[model samples]
Target: MPETVTPLGDGPGSEPGGTPGGTPQPPRGGRGRRTALIAAAVAVVAAVAVVGALGLGGGDGGTGAPPRSGSLVPVTRTTLTERTEVDGELGYGKEIPLPVRATGTVTWLPRPGAAAGRGDTLLRVDDRPVVLLYGALPMYRDLGLTAARPATPAESAPPPAGPGAPAKPSGTAAPRQSAPASPRQSAREVKGMDVLQFETNLAALGHTGFTVDETFTARTAEAVKRWQGSLGLPRTGRVGVGDVIYAGGRIRVGHAGVRVGSAAAENALTYTSTSRKVVVNASAADASWAVRGTAVRVTLPSGTTVKGVVASVGKQATAASEGGGKDGSEQGGAATVPVTVTIGDQRALGRLESGPVTVAYVGREVKDVLAVPVAALVALAEGGHGLETADGAFVAVRTGLFADGKVEVSGRGVREGLRVRIPE
Candidate 1:
């Protein structure tokens, strides 16, 4: 039989734990239930205390797992201190655009885009202008002076026999021969011949105003002036060898419907610009970072290395060359003021033709400073952040020089040997 349970101050025939009045006996089962409830409550309290200490009860004020940390290594002491960071591009300092020197058919000795040296022949003139002169007295003299003298009719006279002596006509004067014809010379005769020759020569040209054998009179000079005006020249009547002459600008040769002919028109040579000046302007923000004489390096299409130096720093802000400027400074006005960098070696010019490149500048260096990856430093809300301590809590830290992906952090709360968590 199970042990019988008893209530305090209760008799066998009375209610369990009842006062002394005669009452019916309470059930042993009720007494046993009260005792069992008390025991179970005590066991539950004990279990909760164990769980709380073990951190299983999350609200028990224990941080679940320690934050992860990475080891730090010593960096070369000479690498710290950089005040400014800037981006820059490469460009040319000086350039020359070769322009058209004379007007004629376009021909290039070295095909377009070819390299040229000083004194290299670029092109040749196709025709040489020529002049011819002639005398005019021959025809005029024959019509006037020579024909003016009338021949006297000879009187009929018997001819003397050659073999046997024959009687000659009495009173027959010997026929007088006209004096040898004297050539009459005159400016008009000479001038007329010149006019004819000039017309013939002018026809040989491309219907241009210039002509050979043309009387080089005041009219000729005026015509030359008109030609000069059309060609954009100073209207000077005289021309020398190699002087530029143009029938009209934009005149092309060897085109459709134009017969190819050798004339003074072909002699006109035109000069055109094959190259130009190009420069790359840098931003003013880079001036302080990029000091004068800062060395820059670049590579060419041929894998050739080129060197350059910082030549100037902009004192004011101005529009940039590449994409204009920033803010409301206007389309071209907003560019960062210029910082000019000239190439140190001329050989580098051969590789550059006014294009893009890379530039770098060095800044101040520091020594023997405690540093870590910039990622490890957590900026504090007040002024800076903190780093994780071995205890899993962040400690306030003061930071110094920041450069090359590293920063100098120091404070009483942080030590060189302290393990700090770097937030991923």
Candidate 2:
């Protein structure tokens, strides 16, 4: 058999005798490259499978290994204050119109920022001072003294003519009894709710000896005389319609509609509280959080921050109209209510008249409580949310206030410095 074996003819790279050139070569380079590509593909598939398993298992590898270092967050003990910021306007509380009942040329007017106290002259019409008085009632009539009258006709008339008196002359009319004049007949007649207001304010102004009632009496006239005398006016014991202006309280002139020499009509001036406050028109839903006495932070236009307290929360909601549809149909808007906030530091407002401001209404507060990023909370199959531990374990937790991207959490194993996992 060995003697019968024959050598095969070689191709291009091999010599015929096949001594030194080369034996038929296999495709080593191509095979090696193909094997490498297959191995690379297998590795990629394995890695993708591992990531898929981790994701499916809720941030935990099926092997029960801890999460990646970047996904761990440590529980912290800190104060978390929940707050909401709302747009507000920095200025006096509310604008109140000061209407002038006296029709005449405006003689004098207070400067826009002038602070007028009760009994202070707000403005002058026809050279008569229109004084400011704190009262809830509007002055509608003059205040003056009225003479007292008999309570009964019998008391007012003389005893029936003596029966013994000669019979009335035939066709002779008995002495005509002049009908008593009505209280309104006198030029000094004074009667109205305005009289009650005048008496109230006079009492507040240190004037005494007057009952605060709707009826004007001699005692009321005395008080009026005292008030008039204090103002350097004649003691006429009377108050004309334009003599006083009623308002909720002392006011700072906000605007003057009528200048000197201008006719004083209904709305002659606008005034507001002298103290600076922030007014927020909050949506009805958000109004509940803006309770009176709630602490707040006010950011002025100049980037200044000041402490404040909610002074009042409006009970009534006001509807705001956005606009009409293209066909002129009405398009309704949100209902909002006003919230008044008073600044604790008035000096910080400086010379700013009115500007847009931001009011952060502080809500629930968690002090020195265990808290974690909201992202760290996980929904457990059992019921409530839980905090995932570093070891792929979830500790049941009771959640409290949520604020500023953090949540107040308490549980068996959730304490400060305990690292929790946040799914990436």
Candidate 3:
């Protein structure tokens, strides 16, 4: 007789051949599941044994060569960067004070948002145009012969030889010392540096025929008269403190300080650079990337990305806004250094004039590093992580920067083009 097979009985505590509805089947279902689980476990053990023979680094597998197939990736040589983004504003940089020096009624002014460039009228005083000049120094004194002193031999003379000073070598004369100035000359003329600065701007405005020097000669007067004639003003041949406004570069009117008809006071209006730039109140700790000449990236309100560079970093720190949960309130706001970033491609900004922008700052980077997919690393029982080869061998690696799903790895065996097995 063939051996009899005991079918899975229904319910626990029920023996084979008991009644058809012998025991509670719900109770029996649990036992049946346990039996199935045991069988599944046995199959898994068999599968693991096969993997051991293939030599996984963490398992008691054979030290065989890496296999030729199965999820594999090659080590790559590339650069890994850690980037951080901060909130920024997109507008003409910081608004600088552009006060007026001309004493007259605000008879005429540029439009509220109008821009001005070299030789352009910023505003009108007594119906005369107040021109714009590119320079760092402001005109504090009139530029005319009255304030200029000649650079004569007396001015260039060296100081007299000190007591007991060594005599000059034979056939070579010593430097002559400058003589003491008389009371009439002791008061001194205006600083020559100021003159040089004024003349530099004067020369840049197509006004030539005079040497750009500290001395404002008669030729310089002639050039000034010509410039005055072009501007439809009285040919005074002199530039007073109120005649022009000195600025770093092209400027755009930002805010009007007073009404159009108001008397022109010391403060006229505020202005900023004409081009759009990004300003970030970066945390003082993040100033490393906020240095001048550091490259960065910017995202516009339209979701467009462009390149930029750090233009300047503020020396002072601003206190963070206190409190929270209110409109414009921030909590634990970090004290920040003002950072100015400028973009080269202005057209890429499209029509975005002023709005919020995101600035990406690079913190740290490792270049020309050998890297592999993070998934390829296996935790070692001994400690740390390792990369398993295809054939069953393992390559111990020292891990570095973890970025963009790739890890920087270096070791005796880690090298570019080396293939490593990845887990499924």
Residue pairs with backbone atoms closer than 3 Å in model 2 (clashes): none
Residues 50-130 of candidate 2 have per-residue lDDT tens digits of 543233344222234344444888999999998867778888867678867887899998888899998789888888788
Tell me the lDDT of candidate 2. Answer: 0.77
Q: Candidate 1's residue-wise lDDT over 290-346, tens digit each?
A: 567776555444556566566666666765444443332333433565556666565
Model 1 lDDT vs. the true structure? 0.46
Per-prediction TM-score, please? 0.37, 0.58, 0.67
Worst 10 residues of 2 by lDDT: 323-332
Which sections of candidate 3 miss by over 4 Å? 1-46, 49-72, 145-191, 285-289, 302-304, 322-331, 345-348, 378-398, 410-413, 421-424
Cα lDDT, all candidates: 0.46, 0.77, 0.78
Distance from true position, residue 227, model 2, in Å? Answer: 3.5
What is the alpha-carbon lDDT for the whole of candidate 3? Answer: 0.78
